[model samples]
Target chain A: MQIVFLLEQVVNGLVLGGYYLLIALGLSLIFSVGGIVNLSHGAFYALGAYVFVQLSGTLGFTAAVAVSPIVVALLGILFERFILRRFYNEDPILSLLVTFGLALVAEQAIRMIWGAAPLPATLPSEIRGSVIVGNMLFSKYRLLMLLVIAVALGGIWLLLNRTSFGRVVRAGIQDPDMVAALGIRLQPYLTTVVMLGVGLAALGGAMFAPITTVHPAMGSEILTIAFVVVIIGGLGSFWGVVLAAVLVGVTRGVTIYFAPAASEASMYVLMFLVLLLRPRGLLGESIAKFES
Target chain B: MKTYQTSRLAGQKSVLTRRTALKLAGGTFAASTLGAPALVRAQTGPIRIGHLTPMTGFLGTLGGWAVEGAQLAAKEINAAGGAAGRQIELMSEDSINPENGATKAQRMLERDGVDFLLGEISSATSLAISEVAARNEKLFVAVGPRSDVLRGERCSRYMFCTDIPNTAMVNAVGTSLKQDGMVDGKKFFTLTADYVFGHDLLAAAKSFFDANNAELIGDELIATDVTDFSPFILKVRQANPDVVCLNLAGNQVTNFVKQYAEFGLPYPMVGFNLNTADAWAAGVGNLSGTWPTVWLDSVETPESQAFVERFKAEYGKIPENHAWISYIAVQIVAKAIEETGSAATPELIDYLESGAKFDIMKARQAYFRPEDHQLIQEAYAFTVKDEGTYDDVYSMLQLDGAVPAPDAPLESIYPSVEGGACKF
Candidate 1:
């Protein structure tokens, strides 16, 4: 019975890890391609939730979840062109500072527009309850969220692996100078990568909004976990991030089952242990641009 | 003008320019030194109140409401010929965390020249601010923190707590649960915030359970930064307790309420502590079960209703308890300063400790308990209205009548001092 209970926690953690993957994957992608840390990725995630809340009131839940990310991705275009474009191939520190500043500005902008009070959001009536299977209780909404995330994860994997765009993006992450020498202008690619990266983050925000408090600083709240997931997964490694997110989610869940006070700290401990073993992260790739 | 003058000064390097600059500086310095004391003797400067609250973390939303409440009260106080005919200069800042709360409190006293300190929502941060207030010997009117330690063993002579303590809250909700026959012989599981406030609430809860024949089957200490309660919820389900109680605070409560509803756990949910802002933020149909609150927007007193009206008009939203508490805190401080005829720390402390009653927008006039410096006042319990019964999220909580009853003493719900840990 105890084993079965722990197993339930592990499965729940996997579902949670999928949510974290949504934010962390974008962070990893933008860093892999653009070499920018993209601290404002969390800002886009926050925008996603706010936009979903605002739109859900009018567009209904399904439409809001579908559209919020696209709206934020459009904003990401402005972000890449006006802000992130200049910082490419520049000092990583400079991009980090700018994005960090942008994150603060975005949070304040959210506060100004929505007010500091967390806006109330809930699951639509159809998915409000839990689903029980063989003595295991699972949130129906979270299970649905897991399905959406799976489709997104599979879609993104195919986009980066099975297409011509994926080939260019992979090449850009490996050697930007060589890609430029081949007359393939990486500017549009960089913008598109940023759009996709932030769009995924927004989707995470939108999907989690019903279950979490939708507040201005929520971006910063989730950013730490995304960074942890990214760090443990290794930079520029898609499968690495996927593995790390699941590891983090499971570790947190199992820890809560035993020592609940250490649940948040469990991820940091995992990162420490992983870093101790593998400095570059579990699946992190050695990129030419970042090394130089 | 100052920038232009400084740039011009930097541009000139000649001996004659240096001599002219030094002479001009000397003349201005002498004039300012001579003129400053005359400004002080007139006694017409604004009374500066240093207000610090958590403005960016889990408790940030309540702090936002706290700021608005204090701002409204200060505006009204200033508009009404000021406190003792002196305008209030409100200096509000984000405490951020406990270490920063103390640092800012010290800076407010030593650098900002604030007359006194007020405001805080996190008990940890409030305790830190109280230490700073004691070191500086400035009266600190804590507006929102409700941990018993703030009024007990760790209580400071310079600090006064406005909100009801953990014991009062437990009693408030516990009484309601007992009335509904949910207490005696029931197995209880609790998810408590892993902090000073939650721990304090848990202590009060344990005592309540012990005295009432209920058993605490299990308890989990939850970190404040935790947003997901799925694993904790699963543990609760595994335990299969008769009732699930929460000692969670701030955004933790709202997130738990939302997710608990999402999971649709069978156990009845109740909590010993909840803020109106968190309850409202949980959204309609998400929050249910009984909870204790220091103040609710639905309280129908003329003053309370009028304050709520003015608050909604100003901020275009219903005010939370933190706002109501802060609004009245400023009023209490202003009244103290007026009756004492000074803003000096000792005078104001003496005046407040004199058991003078002040209207806190409730039916009963609240006064400070001289022993612990806690406000002796009414608190109430609330149960969420059933789904479809309420029109909006803010209206979901239907408040019960004031605890201790209207005819009973205000302090009846509060803990009685057996052996005092507080010393002046």
Candidate 2:
């Protein structure tokens, strides 16, 4: 009932929201440009976490964090080249099924390698303690996580808005054929976009490793939450994801404080309300024009 | 007259040959009898014990520990020349899921040809494999699936459980709560995980509470994979019960305890047998002063001490109840094999059914009661004390008495099972 306690819960909610956004952003990018629901996005996230742990244990956490995204991006390229390339002209459901199967294979492969036990990942010594804000204390790592996510979001925003590559990506999202007619190779651009999306997912996984136990099935668990976030934010809108992430985060935090029993149900309720109000989502374009 | 006399003489000659042959056979048989014991010994071969464990799934860590305990037991038994002068060989396979469990059981039965089947951590998986044992007529010694169904309804004449059932621990905690007057007209709030094991424990605890005049105020069942428990805690605060009973295990318990403290609920929390020493050492500090029912604690006896010392020396950590239960399970199997003088499944079942008393770490003479095939042993009422400089959490109380096994009575508690559905 106390304001301070409520504020602390809200802070906790923001940290969770940050994770949702990290996952949702990648999903949104793939959906808008690649026109596919990559269910295996979560698999990439899991790969990122596992790779982070393996590399961090040897190369240290800092170095692994720096290099893991690039490594994951390369994997993304391979995946797009060998798998997604064939599905470009296939039915959307076909792509979804492919990703779903890929998710299962990835989960089983991870299980075969790492077994099923959760590997504990601790925050570095410098950031492990709590920071007092008024009467409430929040984990310093959470605060740092929020800051890192903000920076990443800002950098992504700039990448989408300011660069020539951003214009080409936006064009591809609108119409891949027109972009191809403009003499830009569509395959390489799609591959780059896929790499960026997967890299972001990997980055999110790596950052999340210290707080949560890293395990093979963690990706599937988080993937469901990410889908909820994406649906609430709008299918493939960049700003919509950011705004929806924060909204969902705050809602979850406040709900937990007031009525903890309804926390999980609250997100579903929000998504339902959003669909009822705007079928295409809060910031997504109306579907009537696209249908024609 | 000459022809008839010649025929009689031939018949007499044949009779004499038959008698000589009988005498020669008797002398040869007497000589071969002296060598029969050695030939029998050579034919019996080493006792092969099959362990089906979950080595790659959600419960894999616990399964790994169970495998370790079984391996240790086999090593010790083999070093002592095994049961009845035969070496022990353990053949293990991964039972990753319920279907996998049945497959693994079949493999152990038809392919590997093991003398006995051991290891099951999940109750549902155990129930699945119990059918395999029932059909195949293999003696299945369950290690840690504490569901009463394994012994009550799904009980096979060939199946014997080594771990304490949920009802035993629930009753132990329930009785302890009654003694402390904690259940006298107190409102009870339950936040149980939604599963068979969780529901069974909650149902048993509720019956005990109701019998002791406790009021059931509120109850909620959360999904097993729900990470955020704040909503449930908020509901608990709103319901405002005097006592809250948690029926969660493993990481869920740890997460619940941490979140409960954060939510600042004022009710005294009591967990029904799900809390263990390893869980406490991991992160039950948030519930520092709470009491939970336990089977084995380190402060109990010299046997427990020696087991803990040996486990720590080998694995570089204290053995939790999972490891201890698993260790005891293997020992019980070995004891049955030794007593029966044969590793045959039928003979092993007979040995277990004989109701012979055996020494475990806590009990002086623990034995499986034939009526239900439940282990009749002492139960512990453990209170989690502050982290010791040396010991992780000191036990505040130890209760020693014969707690009735799971099949004592289900008529008043679970009507569906008691209504001839789960009859032995």
Candidate 3:
């Protein structure tokens, strides 16, 4: 009801959107280049959080945050090279099933290592308080997360638009066969894209670790929302994922403000409306275009 | 089986136990499962106890611990020569949800021919299994899920809950809140888990609010599977209540509390249904506020000390509340069998109804209330430690320092059950 209340929600919404965007982009990227939708992307995220907790004991929080996601990204690369790579040329449904199975395996694996109970992720002393902006207050840690994620996403945008590898990835997403036919060794580049995408998911997990705590099912928990982001953002559209994740997160935040009961449903409602109006998502081209 | 009736106290929400849907479903399922008489009618045959717990889901690990406790108890019971002068056989099946619990319970009853059922932590799962218990005319000692409806609205003669029910858990906190000057006339907001348990917890909190004339600033039902609490926490900030009543459940509670601190909310955390496992899950410095616990590893009672030591010796760690409930559940059921000199469902029910008190590894003697079958025992109000351990749980809070909660006399902890939904 108050202006400050609305302002706070909006700010929190943006921060959450950035958080979700970090995870969604990776899911979208894997789908675009590898022709595989890695449901285990969330597993990568969970692994990242656990890795940070495990490594932080020895490596310290700062170093753990940097190293954890890379470990998960490498884990992702291993899956892609040996397991997921086998499904790239197969049916998309098969890829979905395989990744889903992998998600289960990853969840159980985390459970085995970390135990079933949720483990707390300690807040680094750096971002433990709230900062005032204008008349409203917001979580400083979330704001920090937003800033870091924005930088990462911005760099991703540059890599996609301003770099040579980005061009090939775009082309591969658009036409993997044609890109492969161009004699431009697409396999290694695709692997890089998968690592990039999976790495970001791990980074999102690491960034959120302090807030959400480390748990085995957390990856699956966020994966559902990421899938929503992927579908709503347009599977292969880079900017589409970014904008849509923010939209979903913001809408959810704002919905909670107005109608707490419907907050969970608000994101899906947005997705439904988007699909009704723009079948390929807010900025995604077309499903047929990607398939061909 | 006896049914319980409870009325309001100090303007609190009366925890109506009538779960009509579950009662009907259970009643019908019980009817369908009747007439399976593959039992080895010999009194000396191995007594089978089927454990329907959340074996493979979010609560899977706790479920595993629950079954482990049962195994330990069964081992001890058999070592002393099984209940009713027979060996005890333990069988476990995953009871992730009500539907699964019902189906698996049927499997245990029909195929496995379990003489007794030790069931679920989730209220819904318990309700589902209760239905099968009623249908099959079997005795089920419900250990998890703290829904009072088990003895109230959908009271079944076949089910006896061993753990603290939601009302008692809430009332323990409510009693403290009223005393600590947090409830009366204070504005509060609630973020409850979206399920029967959450609704029940909210009703309990509302009772405290009503008694003390507190204003409910706002309340929200969070879905069971939802991990994100920012949206709800943001709303809590906007409401600016004096306290945030966390009626959330399981891992969601951990997620919500950690995020609450991360966001740096200043409101004092209070309200009902906080558990030891949830606290351990959050780890050090993450847990704030005092909570009501049915069992703690730090209990100084000789019985509790011995149980803790033995449990640790056997399981390599301290037992969380669920694990405690599971172990004691077997002891209670086995003791009933010992007292009645039979493992027959009706006889055990009758013996428990007769106020057959059992030692629950606590200072107090727990007995099933004839009306609701809710075990009557002393529940503790516990504060978290920066670091501690009991059994396998490395981060449990200190038990030596626990404040015996409700600080009210034992009788006031629960008012006499009358006019409740249960009609047996």
Candidate 4:
């Protein structure tokens, strides 16, 4: 019976990890290709939730969820062109500070527009409630969300592996200078990567608005965990983030089962242990540019 | 935002830059006003008050409303005629957390030269500010924190609490639960906020459970920053308690409520502590539980309804309980200053402890208990209305009339002397 309960927690943690993957994968992708941390990635996620909430009031849930990510992805073009483009080849600290500042500005801007209150967003009626499988209980909406996330992960994997665009983006992540020397213009690839990265984050936000508090500072809260997952996964490795997200999620759940107070702290402990043993991360390949 | 002026003449030379002069002025104020009698310091000029609350965090939304309430009170007081014939000048800053809260409170006293301190939503931060006020021997009216510890063993001579304490909140909801036959022989699972506030609430809830013969089968102490509750929810399911009790605060309540609805658990839910902002954020259909609140906009009183109208007109949204508490705190302070003819700490404290009652836009006038300095006032319990009954989030809660009944004593629901633990 105790084992069954622990197993149930593991399964629930995996579902949570899938949600974390939605935000962290985008963060890792942006870092891998552009060498920018994109601190404002969470801002796009927050905007996605806000937009979904606003639109869902008028257009209903399905249409709002469909349109919110596209809207945020379009904003990614302007973000890459105006702000992110300048610090690409500069000191990493410059981009970090600028994006950090932008994150604060984005939060304040959200407060000014939407007020400093959490907006109420509800799951569609059909998707409300839970499904019981033998001894395990699962939220129906979360199951649907897990399916959506799997499809998204699949789509993203194919886009990165089997396309001409994928080849350029991969090359750009390895050596931008060599890619430019080959007349490949890595600039366009960077913008597309940022758009896709932030769009995925926004989709995470839209999907989660119903379950979490959609307020201004939510971006910063999710951003911290996203950074944790990215660090554990190592920079520039897609599969590394996927693995780290699941590990962090499962660790948190199992920790809660035994020692509930340390549930949130378990991820940091995992990160510390991982960094102690494998500094470059589980699947992180050595990138020459960042080593310097 | 009060600017202190220092006029220094060194042989007819005034060469300090504007910024440097201001800095020098702050230094001089700190030096000269360190131990001056409050009567001497507060006799002239504006009644400077420092307002510290979290402007960005889990409690930020309630703090936003708190600022508006205090601002409206200050504006109305100044417009009508300022407190004690002096303009009530406010210097507001964000009390981010406990360490920062103490630092800001120290700065407000030493550099800003505030006569009194007010406003806080987090009990941890409020406890920090109370310690600073005690060290300085300045009056601090804690307007929003509901932690019983603030009025208990941690209580200070120089601090007063305005919000309903945790014991009272448990009693408020416990009364309703008892009437509905939900108390006896019930097994309870609680998800508590893991901080001073949440711990204090859990203690009060344990007492309520013990007194009512209810059993606590399982409990989880959740961190204040946790936004996820699925793992904890699964634990609740495994425990399979008869009632799901929440001892959460701020955004934690809304997050848990929304997710609990998503999970669609079988157990009925109830909470000992809930702010109106958290309830509104959970929206209409997501939140379905009996919760205790200090005050709500739907309270049937002309003054309460008028204040709600004014708040809606100003902010384009209905006022939450934090706003009401802050607004009435300023009014209470103003009334004290006006009646005492002094803003001196000792005089104001004496007048407040004299058992003077003030209208807090409620049926019964509220007064501070001399033992704990907690305001004795009516609290109410609310249950979410059925789906389709409320058109908007603000209208979703069906607020019960004041607890302890109109004929019952207001302090009947409050923590007893042994439980409150105040020495002074």
Candidate 5:
């Protein structure tokens, strides 16, 4: 019984970590490639969840989940173009302030649009209950979420590694000046990266909407986890964020059985230890001076 | 000379006509606008109650219910010529956070000149308003935040608690559940929110468990902001407890309950501080077990029925327990004011603490105990009756039992005026 329970924690942690990785990837991508902190990443996530709630009513559940992320991506493109670009060439502090303001604006907008109440979003009838997995009970919707996240992570990996666009993006992360010196249009690619990053956050939001209640502050709640995942995984390292999310999730999950109060604390304690040992994170490369 | 004289006479006549028309219009407009506001003032001037409750955040829906209940009371009171023949006016602010609640409450009390204050959900926010009440020497009726410490060790002379304290709620539910044979030899696991109210609830619940010889398998205090309950749910499964006692509050409770149902956990659950709004947000199928609420729509009392009907008529839904508490709080204060014929802070507080008994939508009349100013009222244990169909959302809950206040106020489901802990 103890072993099964421990195994269940591992299973639960992996799924939760996958969900976190989906959002953290976008955050890390924006930071590593786009070179913008994009503080409103969580707001886009909240927007995705809220969008899923409304669209699910009209478009049914699956279609809403599919479309909500795209809607957030479009919003992200507009945000990058109109609001974020101005601060890109300035001090990183300015971008942080702008994104922080954007996050607040997004929160208020959600409150005004949907009210402060947590709207109930149910999974489709087919995925409403749990499924038996080798004598263990796992939520079917969660299982679906995990599968979808796996596909998403794979797609992101291929996008960054297998494609020509991936090389340009990778180059931009290492040296934007060199990429631009090669006559590559950095603006369009950077904008795309921002949109994609935000879209990933939205995708996480939309997928997790059925399980997690869609409240206005949800973005802020998940924001910390996304940031932690990225930090632990090593900023700018794609796999680092993914691996960190799993570690954090598993640690927190196991901690729930032994010391639930310490679950969140353990995650932070791990982050603190990692920061002390390797400030650049587990898989982070050479720490470059952040240029204004 | 004759032509110039005729032109001047014509100009003077035109000027006189324009002045006369302007005077007529100005006089009429001033009288109409001035009289309207003056009439409004006469109808609404005497007593102003500041409602500083959370109309946003996790407890927003709960606060909205409170507003509906209190505002309904104000409307009814005004319609029947208000407290002490002075119209009752409600000035409400969204007490979003503790700091904001304190600032806005101070503004409302000192600047807005509210005769009294009412409503709050979060424990910290409620305490902030009560602190203001204590400092300013104003009467504040808290309709939410069921912490016993608020009215116990930190009891305020002017603060009236309308909601059941954690001690009362835990004792009420614990005793009722034990009577129903859910406690003996049961190893209960608790998932509590790591906050003031959750801590109080856990302590109160432990008392009940200890009294009944029910073993506690394990307990965990989760952060209030955590939306996920899967980890804890898995823990409960691993522990294999007979009962899963929920010490969560606000939207956390909603998320936990819904997820618990979704997970199909076999452990029967009981909780302290479960709100009707939480159940509503979780929807029908997710809610289960017998929990104590200050009031419910399905309460059998005539006053409760009347309140539910009136609130439904006004708000287009059954009155939630928060609404009931708000309504009862206003009623208690209004009665105090009417009896004393003053909205003065000390006078009203004195009247309330004199053990003034009043019907609180309960089986019998409840009174504010002078020792703590905690309203000693009957609390109901509610269970969701699985009535084949989910059409009647309002009529879904059945009253499992009523926990009456003991003859000795100190021994009531509430904490000892000195040592506060009630077992659930």
Candidate 6:
């Protein structure tokens, strides 16, 4: 194969990796701090995408992208405060079941509102083209999306590493009781984290609206892949999640290049291998944490 | 509860008003002048056509489009003085799940009291509903599902397909490839979605390849909803097939095509029944130059040209072959009702079986073969073109007749009318 073709595949892989990163990061954040596996994360993603589509026709694409995530984030906050908070002291399995129920509810709500047909979301005219990098051509919108995700990842890293709130969050992840004894309000922080995580998922969904058709079931479809990435990368490890996302994306892209038939099964095989070797995943610390 | 009752009451009032207006416009109706005896004997009730489709769920989008097409046809017929002086009243219910299809058909038949039913985009749902229709002795016009078994082992005298069968579509593509010498000495690799429809399509294509002296190199059956197809792509590349046939639908086809292009596979890929204009547009720039077998396109006939113009004017999109079949289904039912002079289920079935000519897209005068209830028409072969806009994604290339109905012997494929049990 030509080097140019290889470069093109790499570009495609990075673009896909950007989406994986967004989903996996949200999943990691929810699991690490909240001690809850939000199986409904994908539903929120789908809702965000549909909301973006609904608003775009009236508010324009940029305004819809800006506002839809906030609306979805607020819904996430309401979910945490009213429903998820009740399960905080309960078994984690109960939380999983509750979230699974929530996902079903969200899916039905989407179907009732938007019906079953995949609604088309038009790419903004400004970003609708391809760019040549050396001898390979890459979609302009995809490359821009990669750049956007990089900036967002950097911002998230800084948030977790620099701020006082970040320190509190990190402390809570390590020991929630100790953080609570230190006089920090754990409930509010947990709620905020849930909202933030769901907001990130919604943002990813909104961004992806133009790339793929916005359908109700799309969230659940992508959720499975996100879980695979999280499992392989090491749950609750942000940097490890990023690495795993890229690994999965590049592996998928390269396999697509070589054997189109086996591409769909590659990520699962990688996840299985990782689980076989490192039971806690590649960067999972030796802690008795709940599984996603 | 009060609001629901009020809305239902309002719906009843509208129906009453429409009937009253029709009676007034057409002089003293025979039912009013000649009494209840004449009304009962003459079969003067409005023709109730049932539409059972998935108004919600994954396949709902196509269902919505199918409904719209049927409604548009009903509107045209009603506006032009109705069929046989009886207005068409459509009764629609959701058939998203398998069990729901049978239940919905029961509701349409028993409660709604429909004369004939039209529906079902998915093969599984179609089969399920077919049993209900058969049990109730109702004529069914299938609009979208293209499984060969619908007209083959599972065939019912009451079930007539508006959609082209999978075997016929594959035969069209296979015949074109043979004529072009593209199938000669090529190693074929098939990657198909693991489902009834996908497996059936792959089987038909394999049979075609065998007949054409082509070698089957490799095959894989991936699960439906498989997100990442990179590993499968790698396997196909290693197999080094000259021709790759994809038997997938909707978003899966889009993803597969994009991945294939990224892989830079030197061999040309031929898709079976992926030639619809809607799918090509949805795949965007990813599907340029990919040839797929189809039954109709804009370049085929004057009727097709008219359909393209009218459909574009109406829906702001080019009507795919699926849409065309839906459009034709409505027309066929209306014409049959007109010919029989009554909308009774038995009469309508008889009229359909009497071999009435239908003005479909490409075929000048396509008619249902009396023995099998399959529409006999010419098929079109098309290639996807990157015209930079969604409206002009596919360009048609005329090919020789692939399988004319007279030669194919559809009657041999269909089950015997007397003892065949409907298969789900």
* Model 5 residue B145 distance off true place after TM-score fit, in angstroms: 2.2
lDDT of 3 at A225: 91
Candidate 1 ranges beyond 4 A from true positions:
B1-43
Candidate 2 structure quality by residue, lDDT tens digits, B1-424: 3344444544443433545667776876666555545435643788887888766544555676677678777888888888887888888677877898998898777656677788887777888888898889878888877777776767778778777677766776675677677889999898876666677778777877777888888777765566555446645765679998887654556556655654445688887745453244233234533343335555457888888788878776666666777778888888877877788887887788788887887644678767667766666555555433223233422333333334443222222333432445
lDDT of 6: 0.72
Q: After superposition, how far is residue B263 of candidate 6 from its true place, in Å?
A: 3.5
Instruction: For residues A69-186, write the lDDT of model 6, one tens digit per residue.
Output: 8989999989999999988777777788789988989988897887655665656646665555675556566677788789888988888889987898888887788888988888
Worst 10 residues of 5 chain B by lDDT: B415-424
Q: Could you tell me the TM-score of candidate 1? A: 0.95
The per-model lDDT (C-alpha) reads 0.92, 0.71, 0.78, 0.90, 0.81, 0.72
TM-score (all chains, Cα) for each model: 0.95, 0.70, 0.90, 0.95, 0.84, 0.71
- Order the candidates by TM-score, highest first: 4, 1, 3, 5, 6, 2
Q: What does DockQ come to for candidate 1?
A: 0.56
lDDT of 6 by residue, B1-424 (tens): 3444444544444333555556664664443444545336336767788888766544555676677667767877888988888887777677876788888887777655577789777777888888888899888888788777787777787888877677777766665677778897889888886666777788777877887788989887766566545456545655678888887755566556655554445677777756353354243444543344445545556777887787778766666555666667888888887887877778878887788777765544677766567775555455555335445234423334434444665433222445433332
lDDT tens readout by residue for model 3, B113-175: 788788688887888888899999999888977866776887788888887777777777776
What's the ranking of the predictions by lDDT, best on top?
A: 1, 4, 5, 3, 6, 2
Instruction: Please give the TM-score that candidate 3 achieves against the real structure.
Output: 0.90
Candidate 1's chain A scores what TM-score? 0.98
Candidate 6 CAPRI level: incorrect
Clashes of each: 0, 5, 20, 0, 4, 21
True contacts kept of each: 0.82, 0.05, 0.60, 0.81, 0.43, 0.11
lDDT of 3 by residue, A4-64 (tens): 7887777778878888998899888888778787888898888888888888879887899
**What is the TM-score (0 to 1) of candidate 2?**
0.70
